[model samples]
Target: MMDAALQALKQYFGYDRFRTGQDQIISRILNGQDTVGIMPTGGGKSLCYQIPALLFPGVTLVISPLISLMKDQVDALKDVGIQATFINSSLTFSETNERLSAAAQGIYKLVYIAPERLEVSGFVRILEHMHVSLVAIDEAHCISQWGHDFRPSYRAIPAMIDRFARRPAVVALTATATPRVTTDIRKLFGIEAEGVVATGFARDNLNFQVVRGQSADVFLLDYLRKNRDQPGIVYAATRKEVDRLYARLTQQGLAVGRYHAGLSEKERAASQEQFLYDDLTVLVATNAFGMGINKSNVRFVIHYNMPRNIEAYYQEAGRAGRDGEKSDCILLFAPQDIRLQKFFIDQSDMDETLKQAEYHKLEQMIGYCHTETCLQAYILRYFGERNPSGCGHCGNCLDTREKTDVTVNAQKVLSCVKRLRERYGKIMVAKVLAGASEQKLRSLHLDRLPTYGIMKEQTQKQIGEFIDFLTAEQYLVQQGGAYPVLALAERSLPVLKGEARVLKKGHIRAERLAVDDALFEVLKQVRKTLAQKEFVPPYIIFSDQSLREMSARLPATDHDFLMIKGVGQQKLEKYGHAFMQAIAGYQAEQKNAVN
Candidate 1:
C-alpha cells in the first residue's frame, strides 16, 4: 500500500517523496484508523489524504469549508488526471445532483463537499448509498471552540459519520492548532493521543519580520517597488484599510486587487480569481481573505496592522512561500494598532472569559513585535514548542543594527508610570515625561510631578515610542480595553530599581528577495501563456520553484525534465513538449548569440 501511495504521488503530484508527516498520516489512514494531522501552512497537508484517496478502492469524501477551496482543490486534482468534483452552493441544484449522481455511480475517485451539505437529509441519503471509504476533514480546527476560527457547523460532522452504516476511517487536518485545540479535536474524533501526527509548526523558507515605528505606506511602497515582479498580499485589520491601501497601490499603477467582507461576493470572487490567476501581482485584503488559498508563488505577506493574535498572524503569514521558495512575512506595527485590536476585542460578542483570552493573546502578539529575541523562536514558543532555537534568517536574527543601552531611559518611563498612579494611557505618560505644557496636563497637575521633564531632551513622539517599547518588553503593562492605561509589571520593578538593563536595536530596512534569472523569466512567460490557454492559474501548470529548477537545469530531454521536482508523469505527458521546446529554444539562442 505504501509503495502504491508512492507511485501515485510521483505519477500525479510530481513529487519524488512524501513531506515530513504525509507518509505517517497516509499510512495510518490506509490502515483504517482515525488520524489527526497538524502541519504548518505549506507543509503539504493536502497530500496526506490525496495519496490515500487514489489508493483506496471506494471513493473518498473530502469535507471542506470554503467554496474557493473546494473549487481550487478539485480543479488541481482534475488537472493532474484524477477524477474529482465538488458539490457546493456555487453549483446549481441540478448541477449538484448531476455530480452527486456521478459520484454514486463511482465515477469520481474524490468528491469535495461543504460541511453544510451533510446537514441535508437528501444529501446524506445520496452519500449513504455511495461506497464511501474514507472521510477527510480539512481545517479541522474549526470544530474546536478553542480555535481562533470556530464554526458550529463542524460539530455536526461526528453525528453524520455515525449515520454511515459502515463507518469509514477519518482524518482531520489543520495548519494552525494549539495544544488546547489539538486536544479538543482528538476528543471530538475519539482518537487517542498517540493517533495524532504533528510535523511541527515551522516554515524554514519564510523569513519572519516585525517593522515598528515606520511609515507603513512608505515602507510598503518601497518594498513593492523593489520586488515589483513578485506576487504578494498586504493584509489589513479592516475593510476600510484594505480599500485605502488598494486605492493607493492602484493609483501607483501597480498590479493590485482588494478583498474584504465589505465587497460584494462577485467583487471578492473576481479579486480572488485575478490574484490566483496571477493577473494581479499583489492583493490588498483583510483577514477575511486567503484561507485555503493554494497559490504557491506568493513571495511576501505584509500585515498593515497587528493581527488579533499569533495564530491568525502565523496562518496569514504562512500563505507566503507555500511552494517551498524563500518568502517574507512582515508586520508593520504601531501603538495605535494595539488599541484598534483592543477595540475589536471589546466590541466582539465573546463572553468575558473569551474576551480575556483574546486580550492575553493580543499581548503575546505585541510581545512578538517588541521582543529582541529571535522572531521565529518567539512564535514557536507561543505555539507550545519546547526551547526552540533562533532561526538565523528572521528579522531579529538578521538584524545587524547596533543595540543601544536604554536602561536609564526605561527607568525614567517606569518611574513616570508609577508617579502617574497608573491611571493614564501612554500618550499622557509621554507628555508628562516630555514636559509638554498641554492644558490637560496642567489641569491635572501632572506637569508638577518629579518625573516630569526628566526625558525632555527627547521629543514627545520618541518618548511615546519608548513607552510602547517598554510595554512590549513586559516592563510596562497596558491594562483596560479600548482605553488602556499604562501600569508597571514585575519586570519593570527590576528596571526601576536599576537591577536590569534594556537595550533596543536601531531601525532595520526591508531587503528585496532574490530576482529571477533571464532564463527563468523566459520560462515564466511560457507558463503564463500556457495558463491563459488552459484558463487555469499559472502555478497550476508549474510553480515558480519548478520554473527555477527548469532554468537552472536547462533540461534537453523528457528524462531530464522529469528529474525536476513537481514534474510527474501526468504533467510530463501533458506539458513536457512545450516546456522542453522553450528550454531548447533558449539554449539555441545563447549558442547562436555566441557564434
Candidate 2:
C-alpha cells in the first residue's frame, strides 16, 4: 500500500505534497469510505481523485454530467503523463467500445463517463464487472431537484452506485451548494464517511463589485471597452440574450465566442474547444458555461444579468481569480431582473410549494442586494458559514453610502400602497404617486384616489426607487400568485402605526466602481515612476488587478509586494523595484495606514 501510494504521488502527479483538502479526502476513499467534497472552484478538487486513481488497484470511475468537463480533465491528465480516458455520447460506437474494453482490462488509471451514457447498454455490466477502485461524482448537486441546474440523468448515479456492493468509495465534488443542497448531496450518496471541506465562500483575492440600473448591452459594452484585452466571461440569463450580445460584441471587433443551450452540439463543442485552447479572448455565454472548467488565467466574470440564486452566482463568479491573482466579479443589476427570473420560474412545471420556495430564495437575494452588510459576508452566511462583519473587498465595503432620513418618504409610500388598496402593480402606483395623468390610469379611476397625485413632491423615477427601497427594507412585500401584486409587508404596520421611527438608506453609484480616482491617480504616479525607472509599458509593469490591489492595500515591503496579486517570482524580480519605491513614498506621507 505504501509503495503504490508513493509511486502514484511521485511518478504520476509529479508533486511533492497534497493540496489542503486533497489528501484527507483520498485517505477516506482509500480506507473504503464514501466521501463528499463541497470544495470551492480552483480548490484542487480533481487532484483528490487523480491521485487515488493511481494509488488504488482498480480503475477509478469519474461520473461527470458535462462531456466537455470530462474531455478537459482527460486531456489535462494526459498532458501531465497520466493515463485517463472518457466514454460519452460525443464519441462514436467504436470509440466507446474500445474505451470500455480498455477499462475492463484495468489498463487505464482513470475513466470518465457521462451520467446519461451510463444508463445505456453495455455500461452497467462493465461497471459491475470491472475492478472499479472508486466512483467520483463531479458537480453532484445537479442530482437534486432544488438546484437551478438540474438534470434527470443525474438520478441514474445511485442506481450505478448501487450496482457495486463493495462500491468503490463514492467521492462527490461541487463548487457551490447551499446548506440545503449540501444536505441533499449527503443523503443521495448515502455516504457514512464524508470529507466536507467548505473553503470560505469569500474570495479575498477577487474584488466583488456591482453596477446596478443599466441595460445589459450598455453595461457589457462599457466593461469590454475598459478591459479590452482581458480574459473574461460575459454571462447572460438566456440563449437569445447570449446571441444578441455575441453578435454585437463581434461587430465591435472584440475576439469573442458564444455558447448557450440553443446552439447545436457541434457548435457548442467547437466553441468550447477554442475557448480551452485560448483561441477566444472572451466567451459570451448563458449560465451554462464554465462547469468544471480547468482554465486558471480567467481574470474576470461579468454577469450581464442577475443569477437565479447566490449558490449559482458564487459558483459562476468563483471561476475567476483561480491562479491567486487579482480578479473581479461584477454584477449588473436592474429591478427588472426579478421579473425576468419570475417569468422563467412560472414556466417551469414545479408545484406551487416548490415554486414558492424558489421565489422566496430570489427575494432573499434581492434583500442581499439592498443590504449594507458586506456582499461577501452575506454570501458566506447564506451558505452556512459565519464570516466576520465586512470583507472590505465588495462594493458595499469599498464605497461610501449617504445616509438619509427617509421617515417621511417611507410613510408616503406605505400610504400610497394602502390608499391604492394594494390592488395595482408598481407601474400604476408609481404613476399615481408621480401625478402622471395617463389615459389607461384615468380609465381605471385611479386618477381620483384620495392619495392619487398627492405624492407630486417625488418624481416618477424617485418613487420607483423608494418603492424598491421599501420592498427591500421589508416594509413592503411583493404579493406572489398568478400575477405579482404589491402590498405592504408585515413590518410596515409597525413603522406606519408609529411603533418605530425610520432609518437611513444607503445607495451605490456606478461611476465610482467604474473608476476609482484615488486609485487612478496612484496608478498614474506608479506608472510614471515605473516607466521611467524600467522603460516598459505601465500596464505590463502592473496589470489592472495589481494596480487595484496597490490602491486598496498599499504594500511597501518586498514580502508585502509578493502578497500583491499577479506578481510571480519573475515579475517581482524584474518590476518589483518601482512599486516598492512608490509604496514606501506613499506610506511615509500617510498619517493613517493603508489598512
Candidate 1: tens digits of C-alpha lDDT, residues 220-323: 99899888899999999888999899999989989999999999999998999999988899999998899857898999999999999999999999999999
Tens-digit lDDT track for model 2 on 425-509? Answer: 7777889888898998789887887778767987887788777667655677677655666898888888888787677535443
| lDDT for residue 306 in candidate 1, whole number 0-100 | 94
Worst 10 residues of 1 by lDDT: 507-516
Q: Over all chains combined, what TM-score does candidate 1 have? A: 0.90
Cα error, residue 268 of model 2, in Å, equals: 3.2
Best by lDDT: 1
The whole-model lDDT of each prediction reads 0.89, 0.74
* Per-candidate alpha-carbon RMSD to the true structure: 3.2, 8.5
TM-scores across all candidates?
A: 0.90, 0.72
Q: Which stretches of candidate 1 lie over 4 Å from their true place?
A: 405-502
Q: Which ten residues in a row are the worst by lDDT in model 2? A: 508-517
User: Candidate 2 local accuracy as lDDT?
Assistant: 0.74
